[model samples]
Target: MIESISRRKLTVTQQLSASFLLVILIGSLLLSLPLMHNSNAPATTYLDHLFNTVSMVCVTGLSVVPVSQAYNGLGQLTAMLLMQIGGLGLVTLVSLSYYSLKQKMTLSDQSLLQSALSRSNSSGLRPYLFFIYKLTFCLEGVAALILMIDFIPRFGWGHGIFNSLFLAVSAFCNAGFDNFSTTSLTAYATNPIVNITVAFLIIAGGLGFANWLDLVRRFKAYWLEKPRHFKLAFQPLSIHTRLVLYTTATILLLGTVSGWLLELNNPGTLARLNPFQQGMVSFFQSVTMRTAGFATIDYQAANKSTNLLYMLQMIIGGAPGGTAGGIKVTVAALIFLLFKSELKGQKQVVFRNRSIPQALIRQTLTILIFFFLALLSGYFLLLITEPKLDSFSLLFEAISALATVGVSMDVTPNLSTAGRFIIMALMFFGRVGPITVLLSLLNKPEKNIRYAETDLTIA
Candidate 1:
């Protein structure tokens, strides 16, 4: 057991996972302090606080208690900090601190950062890290300004500015925990200013740092061109960047259009609004449903079809290396292409005239299968633990937990201890990724042994 522990300790992924767990435990203790909650509200339990800490640290918005009622100003700030760290990642944050302090990173530090961001090793890692922070804060600052346009007039200056900043960070992190009472963004469902700003933040954050770096490079080349050369032909994007953009756009379009059509006559959601308002709400929900947890409509009252659609969307999620979490857009796209190629009887799946490696296909399928397995396992556990809860609600909760998209069907708070524990484990696995967690458990291969291949027939 000690040898196994020692071996696992040497893995970068395991270390990172341990770091997050440590952070959550510490944050839970901090949040459980009596000072964190309002004096009039009931005393917050350690379990509830731990759940909130995991949710924030995972950037999953699931909560056993409403943010506004459970937390005072300090607790809210602590939650935001946790989300920021989770979104940026612990390694990125440490790297930035080192950069600020003029300290050189060791090889081990670089490896950890690379693993966390899933970025290829580069000589310019430090510069890229700086760029990430610069871009993140800049986007959040702009978003805060736009949000304040609505918040200020309603809540006044002091409260509005704080709320604006909080919301901006939450949106950018794709962390849906909001301090604005129970309804989330429902109050601003028709408010284009708030909806558009939050939606923009979420999308921008979900595009992933690598895609942003590619865009920046392209922009720089174009900007530096001479007037005569301004008509310069653009270089094509990298395959990864192109795939992420295409899949993201496709999902957003499909979700928005389908949501509009599906919920058009559903009274509690999109039906009561005018055409323009309905369009705005549809677009917002489409954006949020992918990863962000904010809801413009009461999803509990939404149709079963819409709920099912959201489950699929949550599973698909946003781009990798981004604030959003799920199976990842690239994996989803690859799986779709794999199906397309299979149906065409092609031995190789090709995208953009390039044949994808078999290893990648296998990896994608493995991740998807593990996700479903975890979801099924958690759903069954929830059914056993919370027998009174309906299957649909339990399944929805399980999916939400595993996808790290915390849009609950009014069932999260009411869950029993065992159910919460199951959800918490699912949240951790979802954020860290099932493949990652599995990989962390694995030690270096002692030897590579070739085995004869065997095939099994299927229907």
Candidate 2:
């Protein structure tokens, strides 16, 4: 009976969603401990703790309190652990460990793993997961080392090491929580080592684990003195990879230029900095706006255009099946591709020389529709609950928190309890994903009788 139960089939989305929910519940309890509270043992409300816990576990850096000032060492460490687990993905870890332990992987387990990694049932999947683990550690270690150079000299070795590790995990996970204040990086805003290191780590992590796996395989094959069979052996990047890279590049470039153009005139923020520092700040903002929430400038003081640009960046966000969140880069790319294909009068939509599956297109559309609705609904609810807040800031906060982007207008802490709950739900749904949660709640669809094809035109 037990063996049969273990072998029973489950939808990949359902399993992943359930796993995330379980993690959230467990995390909430863990974070609510008195030890996790600050020195004053300030009256900790259950809902606040729950919201913060969910945010951390979702890898969304939105917080009701200033994280650096509110949490003690234990709480901070707990938050970091939650972010790492959430970023790595609960389902991916289970699947990796199952295979590593030489245990039999059930069909359900395999399906979940494939979904988590956004890969098909290819023979390379296992090796890909192993390589992902190795790649993540190596990249994170290098990022930590580079960041430590900036941190250690000013702060002592112990504090420096802690900050380095925290920042490394935070960057790789695309969680924007930073112990460093605006004042902290102000000194090193133009420091090449700090900017490049963090940027590299964020981009690498944002690229998604599947891309890392492909690059690793290609590099290993090339380095092993393998015969160069260009046409037969070379594996081109998949459609998902191409979409992510193109969209991310376009957004980053445009965001940086637009930010620079808009903010160069702001006397308090950008105008004070030298031209080089201004450019660096703009570039860093562009890179970090997507999902990594580290800010070199005070977001509250950013000009109107820059704020709007950052909000747009937060909405498009990073790639699928990775730590970063939002509607996802691929989803936005697909929408664009679909529009272009329609304009060209093409029957089928194609990306990277391959036809995108209709199911995927439908899924992407569903995600976008639900995501926008959720954001708007959350925003409206917040507006009603906290009527005193600025509408634009509230809207930005709602979308950012819901999408797990973590970019804020610096109003997170002032939100009411109801507002916090709404944001928490958004973070939870965003991290587990709309499609996954929808699938879990709805379960597998039953087959329907076939009907004659008919066309109905509207619009």
Candidate 3:
């Protein structure tokens, strides 16, 4: 298999998988340097450094130690840079640098972007990529300024500005990393400025990048056509954008309500807060639980129902082509639609008067199965590696890492060496995507001969 792969040119999937792995290894090396550690902090093994680097580059945020306790300022900046590279695709960044230099695209770079976006050609790829980069940095900058209002007043100029920028990047990358404290953002549970700013960054970054571009184009077209007549003209949104928006809104509303109700009477979690404050925290929890991974309340203190709900949300995650992970919102929505059509005894799956192609339905199921298997395999491995840990917490941690959600029931710090390795593997799989990784390794050729089809027994 190795010989065959070496002889053949690598496909786009293989290149992307290789690129991410390369970044992870390089990041681990950087984090292992002695200068990366705090002088007052205890010595760390290369294993710990690798683990931390993997967590940062994957944007999974499952650290064995609090970031502040582990590293100094330069170290934190390195980690932040890892999050940026991972959140923005490594290949995409390379393409961006080429654009900056006004260089013609290499065949490999053009092929990579085309495959990444599933576009037929590269005609509009340049403009689309530029828009995504500009939008991402602009949003992060705005969010950092907003957060400075809260952080600068408390930490003084230097620390405050750095903290604000770090958090803004972390939030917008949907990374759970916080230099604030070991508990993530618990200190600012009821602080409106922190909660709103962080939540906005997460949502904006999680919303599919293409969706934003689509919205902008539609807005421009509508305004340009306004002078044609007194009547207003609105462009129809793409089905992908419509589905993402609807699924996101529904999940947010349901998650907020479920969290609020689940923790209403639990003094350990949200019961101590006034009703208005509880609402604020509940909304933030809903926003972060779906793969953003920041925490306002102690998740372990909450009822079992809330944790269960969050795991489901984590599995659903954010949109495609976005910083967030998991199978993604569109995949979840398509699966639901697939089931609805099947239960209704309809031959075709339909959404918004548009009949879904069979190819898309199959692709959606394939993605779901890949993620499901990864989650289960990771959970079982964690069980074997850390038998002393609570089975429920182990399962929770597995889902968190595999979905790249990063929330835990305080299970991360106590993870055995083997357990930490397992979580790191899961985080990488979640970021690069299980299917993409698997496909990259296989050397099999397509079978042209077809066998006779037969129907299976129905349940």
Candidate 4:
């Protein structure tokens, strides 16, 4: 025990979890201060602040209190800073600090940073990380400026500038915590500028930094006429980028079309709007489902079919190595390919003529399996804890927490203490990932021993 307390090293996952826990605790304490709340702020417990801090740090937008009513300007800014840090990730920001200070990173630090960014090659990791930071801040700044166009006259310079910047970061981070009251973006359901700007930021952030880097490289290669053919130029992109793009496009298209069709005649959702606004709203909602929490329509009043659609969409979320959450689009794509290959009686799972390794397939399956296990566990636990709440809504809340999507069904504020704690666990696991958390606890390697194979009947 004494030795354990001495100077010791931590694995990447442990470092990540510890850094995040530190931020969450510190943010919780600061935000819980009386100075952070408004003069007439609603009463709240330390648990409320902790839960909010966890949600913010996890980039899950679920909240037990209306941010505007409970907190003053300082608190809102603090929350925004939390979202920014969470979205960029602590590892990323720390690396930026090191780089800015002209400090050489140790090999261990480099490895940890690469792992955090889901990057493979360490040779160009620093450049790639810097590129990500530049792209993120640049996009956020542009979106903020655009948002101010609509926000200034409506909210005035002081509130407008701050709100614009806040929402821009929130949307880009996919954090979804809004100061616009408890209704989220429902009041701006038909506001095209707001919807389009927010949706664009969501997509840009959700695409993942690695994919963006690949795209930039391919574009530069094509522009210089090296291998001239666009196809050949982009051929250098990793299979991961291709799958993420394909899956993201497919999900967005399908989600938008299905949502439009499902909500066509439903007065509670898009029925009251014009066809154009309905289309816009449908598209926005589809984008938001990729871990962006803003909701133009009241999901509670939405069609049951739409609710089911959202749950499925929320589970198959945006690309990995970005602000977005859930099992990730790559996992969904791989699982689908795995099934398709098996159904076709193919010897190997192939995508784009390249067969995926068994190890990666196994990893994908592990992630999916653990994800569902956590989701289901949280759902059942919520049912037991919040027995009086609507079962469907409770299930939605559970999925939202576990996916780190933060889209609640008006069930968050009324949650009991146990329910909030359960949600917090789910949120933490969701953001850090089930495998990551498990790996932190049980990180030792197993003996490389094999046993004789045995067969079992499928039927």
Q: CA lDDT, every prediction?
A: 0.85, 0.76, 0.84, 0.87
Best-performing candidate as measured by TM-score: 4
Give lDDT: candidate 2, residue 372: 88
- How high is the lDDT of residue 143 in model 4? 97
Best candidate according to lDDT: 4
Instruction: Please tell me which model should have the higher TM-score, number 2 or number 3.
Output: 3
Alpha-carbon runs more than 4 Å astray in model 3: 1-8, 117-121, 223-235, 434-453
Ranking by TM-score: 4, 1, 3, 2
Better of 2 and 4 by lDDT: 4
Question: Residues 308-362, candidate 1, lDDT per residue (tens digit)?
Answer: 9988999998998888888989999999999999999999999999999886787
TM-score of each: 0.94, 0.88, 0.93, 0.94
- Model 3 local distance difference test score: 0.84
User: Model 4: which ten-residue window has the lowest total lDDT?
Assistant: 1-10
Model 2: what TM-score?
0.88
With a 3 Å backbone cut-off (N, CA, C), the pairs that clash in candidate 4 are none
Per-residue error for 253 in candidate 4, Å, reads 0.4
Please report how far candidate 4 places residue 28 from its true position, in Å. 0.6
Better of 1 and 3 by lDDT: 1
- In the range 1-459, model 3's lDDT, one tens digit per residue, is 111211227766777777777788888898889888888877788888888878887788788887888888998999899988888877778778778888887666676776555444678889988998999999999999999998999999999999999999999988889886778999999999999999999999889788888878877787787365434433377888889989999999999999999899999988899999999999998899778889988888988888888889888989887888888998899988989998999999999989998867866877788888988899989989999999988888998898888888999989998999899999988988743743433324545898999999987
Of the pair 1 and 2, which is ahead by lDDT?
Answer: 1
Q: What does the lDDT read for residue 132 in candidate 1?
A: 89
Give one digit per residue, the lDDT tens place, for model 4 in 277-375: 999999999999898888889988898899899999999878988889899998899999999998999999999999998867877888888999999
Stretches off by above 4 angstroms in model 2 are 1-12, 38-43, 122-125, 180-188, 222-235, 435-459
How many backbone clashes are present in model 2? Answer: 1
